[model samples]
Target: MTTVAILDYGMGNLRSVAKAIEHVAPGHEVFVTSDPARVAAAERVVFPGQGAMPDCMRELDARGLRPAVMQAAASKPFLGICIGQQMLFDHSAEGDVPGLGILRGEVVRFPDAAMQGADGLRLKVPHMGWNEVWQRQPHPMWDGIPDGERFYFVHSYFVAPADDDIVAAQTDYGLRFTSAVARANIFAAQFHPEKSAAAGLRLLANFIRWQP
Candidate 1:
């Protein structure tokens, strides 16, 4: 039986994620765990985080999950969501805190000017609600999903990976931001699949059945 561990770093909705995964993949053992050893032992890891970057970074280290999370990303099928996705990068504008550096990129806040639409309408800083995520490249996570699907998003900052090839999907608020990233056994998103209805569920389902 496949074991999926949702990293419990004292952040985000871990239970909701576990339930979502359960709905899609019934046979898998899905559980929320803060234990680093359990994380390392799991067949798959889902890193879901919320709150500020600095606090999240501190908690991850405090819980002794930094190394295990990085190792999992490198060795097995890994999925990162929302703040979880941002922390995979090198740095974040939020408190100017550094990230795991697993991926070569930086997290930056949406510039105030970039918040203005072409019609002079201003969008909110935290880009909440559903927005269309445009596919930047072909990816396994996007297998059954369409090119432009609406997903739930609630974030002020976004990742800017040094390599554009790592970006799997892009979304436009006032500007285009890297919304989803994928490379090998890793796939991450800036939206909440648990709150995203069918499209979100599809991605989770795909991840559950993903071999790498």
Candidate 2:
């Protein structure tokens, strides 16, 4: 049986991610694992995270899971959620932390200058709630999901990939930002599919069927 590993390095809602994956892809086994060997051996990888970057990095390093994560990021079908997506970049301003450098961008906080809408309305930092994700390019993970699908998002910072072509979807809170990015064998998003409704489920299903 194919196995998908949800990396468990003590940071975000791990079980929710696991359950969502299990619910959508029942044929595959989902394991919420912290063991390096398990993560290294999984057929596919889901790196999910929440919380501060410094702490997330610290925990990942402490658990000796960084090597495993790097290996998986290079060779497997990987899905990164929320902070998990942020950690793929080369750096993050959240705590002046360095990421895995798998992606060519920097994860940054929403600019204070761009924090307010054109109408002079100030937006919150975490950018919480449901927002429409505008599809920027065609991809397998976006299969069945509409061109402008709304997904549940709760994030303060977002990725700014150096390359624009890799952006799969865009969303606007106070300002437009990359909501999802796809390249090679990876599909990452700043939203929580587990918290999203029908569209989210469909995305998970598409991910299950995704050959990449």
Which model scores highest in lDDT?
A: 1
Clashing pairs in 2: none
The lDDT of model 2 is 0.90
State each model's CA lDDT, in order: 0.93, 0.90
Model 2 residue 98 lDDT score: 96
Question: Residue 81: error of model 1 in Å?
Answer: 0.3
lDDT of 1 by residue, 105-166 (tens): 99999876647867789887888899999999888788799999999999999999999999
- After superposition, the stretches of candidate 1 with alpha carbons farther than 4 Å from their true spots are none
Error at 46, model 2, angstroms:
0.3
Model 1 per-residue lDDT at 173: 91
Candidate 2 regions exceeding 4 Å error are 118-120
Instruction: Please provide TM-scores, in order, for all candidate models, with all chains considered together.
Output: 0.97, 0.96
CA lDDT for candidate 1: 0.93
Highest TM-score: which candidate? 1
Model 1 is weakest, by summed lDDT over 10 consecutive residues, at 110-119
**How well is each residue in 123-185 modelled by candidate 2, as lDDT tens digits?**
777788999999999999988888888999998899999999999999988879999999999
